[model samples]
Target: MHINFPLILVIAVAVAGLLALLDLVWLAPRRRRVIAAYQAQVDTPDPQTLERLDKEPLLVEYGKSFFPVLAVVLILRSFLVEPFQIPSGSMKPTLEVGDFILVNKFAYGIRLPVVDTKVFDVGDPQRGDVMVFRYPNEPRINYIKRVIGLPGDHIRYADKQLYVNGEPVPRDLMRTEPDDEVPPGHPLQSLAKVDIYEEYLEDSAHLIRHKRLSQPARPQEWLVPEGHYFMIGDNRDNSNDSRYWQSDQMPRELWGMVPDNYIVGKAFAVWMHWPEPKLSNLPSFSSISLIH
Candidate 1:
């Protein structure tokens, strides 16, 4: 089952804050009054007795201790930056599996957590940006892909070439090399070799890869409606992205596009890579670099 982390965080912060507030408003005052009455009855106030009287209830104490930390985490994660791990090679050569990347949460806008209502407009996503967004078919799942088309743009992919607004996007072949990173028993491992290319999406230039002998996908075209975007993976033929989202099973209006509201953030940088969970293998920081 998918856990609603943001919702859980918000609830924890609220409960903790309430507990602290309860101690400040009701319990602490009552304790102070009792201590004062006892001190007035005795000739000398005992420090031990005063300390015991002033001690907070365990639940309240824990709540007060945790509130500030939880609040700060919520604010930072929801508005500033959030960390994510790449789970697949959909963005191969750009982002590898196990890469820990930081997403700029406020790059697109400031949206309230859980409910995801945008309260502030910072900016809209630009072409060529690597973005993370909730899957259109399943909002609970997050998927990352490159932004290919903005609202009202024409997008077409034919013969493995991408065309935006009737112009074919430029690409330069870099090299043909064996993919050593392919996991064991993967189908792509049988391909033997792949072609690497530097694709130019406006001013941003990024590397993309395609299996040398793999069959090309069926030609497709899309008109990006207002408030929606066209996204495609940097792995080209291997990615399950906006290109494949359109199907007879789905409604036409909801086909092959990422709605503005489903956007999470722009992936800015990769900080670490730990592909395997084995204790013998350690994570490496050598891949740390700003994402294109």
Candidate 2:
């Protein structure tokens, strides 16, 4: 099960902030009074008065010191930028497994952290933008995909080709190369005969993978509704996207166009990448670069 980290952070901040406020309003004044009283009777202070002046609850001390730091982190993560690690190859050439990316939280406008209510009119996501959002099927889990269709767009995917508003998106084949076996430990290791193509979406060109022998399933055409978007993965055949999510196994929540409010952030850059099972000769800075 996915953990609701944002909700947890919100709850933590509220609790800590409350404790800190209480300490400032009530506890601190009480402590000061006890200290003043003891000081006034310093020459012959009673044991009870001295004890009251010296002792402090550990919880109060922690709340005073930690609450400010937590509040700052909450503000930064919720509105400025947040870091995320890529866990799957759905975005492959654009984003890879183990790549740590920074998402621009305010790029699509600022939103309340846990509830995700957008409060500012920053900007809308354009076609070809890579976005991270809560998975519709499971709201707690996050998913990343490229926006292919904006509001009022007629999107079609047939025979592994894309069409927008009845015009075929230009795809210049850079080259066709032999496919690679799905690496060990991959979920789709059973898939075979994969081919790679360098396809361009508008001026932003990127690589995509497809299975040569397998026919594209369920040719689809969708008229994107207002305030909703159509998204797809760069790994066309291997991805579970808006075009191929009507399975009975998938919950109804996971189906249909993604709402604008569901967007989390625009994925801007890859800050770092580290391959698993660390190798000695691995190029340290090979994957350290800006994301397309």
Candidate 3:
């Protein structure tokens, strides 16, 4: 299962913020009074001296630390584009499994955190543009794919080719990038992954690897419903996108219909790489754990 990083960040921040607020409201004032009262008892040292329990000041210290950190993280993740590491080769070539990518959080405009309600106007996903968005099925999950179908357009996939608005999305084969698999009896051959064949996703396109000659073979047609989009991966045959699961609905609340508010941003470049050094070098969450 995909790790819900954003949700985790949100929850951690929110809980810390709540605790901080509670201390300010209920505990801070009480601690002051209790401390003052204990001082009074110390001064008197009468026969019926009352001893107060020690409040370790734990909540105050933690609130001071965690609350600020969480708040900053919340604001950054919500307003600015957040960095993400590709855990799979779903976006191979353009984005390898280990590439660290930055999402344009404000590209689609700023939105409230948690609720994810967009309150400003920014921009829309253009044809052939790569986008990262909250997976509608689960907003807690983020899925990166190229935006193929916009609202009110016809999109189809058959024989590993994309059909948009009754026209085939064209691809001009460039050259096959070297496959990463090392020849047998050589060194560790796990890094054999390579950008198979380069193809223009249209006029404005990106490079991708198909692993083999076979691409996606879904023969289906779809009308890009209003407020919805048709998404597909540059690695056609291997993508589970609108064609396979059918076009997804992009409603604002579901975060599935990826309202502009849910737009994370465009990925620009790679930042790091790490081969699994196991049977397969493609990085996984477990690999990221090892990285940690």
Lowest-scoring 10 consecutive residues by lDDT in candidate 1? 246-255
Residues 1-292 of candidate 3: C-alpha lDDT, one tens digit per residue: 7676667888887777777787778777786776677767676544333233334257666766788878787788778867776766666556666566667677767777767777887887777777887776666777888888888888776766667888876665666554543467655454444444445545665665555434446488877767666777766656665555433454323222345545667665454465444456653443221110
Top candidate on TM-score is 1
User: lDDT scores for all predictions?
Assistant: 0.92, 0.81, 0.65
lDDT of 3 at 38: 75
Off by over 4 Å in 2: 44-55, 175-178, 181-194, 246-254, 275-285
Considering TM-score, where higher is better, how would the candidates rank from best to worst? 1, 2, 3
Q: Report the C-alpha displacement of residue 6, candidate 1, in angstroms.
A: 0.8
Q: What is the TM-score of each candidate against the true structure?
A: 0.94, 0.86, 0.68
lDDT per residue as tens, model 2, 159-210: 8899988988776554544435457767655545566667667767667777
Find the number of clashing residue pairs for candidate 1: 0
lDDT of 3: 0.65
Query: How would the candidate models be sorted by lDDT, starting from the highest?
Result: 1, 2, 3
Model 1 pairs in collision: none
Report clashes for each candidate as comma-separated counts.
Answer: 0, 0, 9
lDDT of 1: 0.92
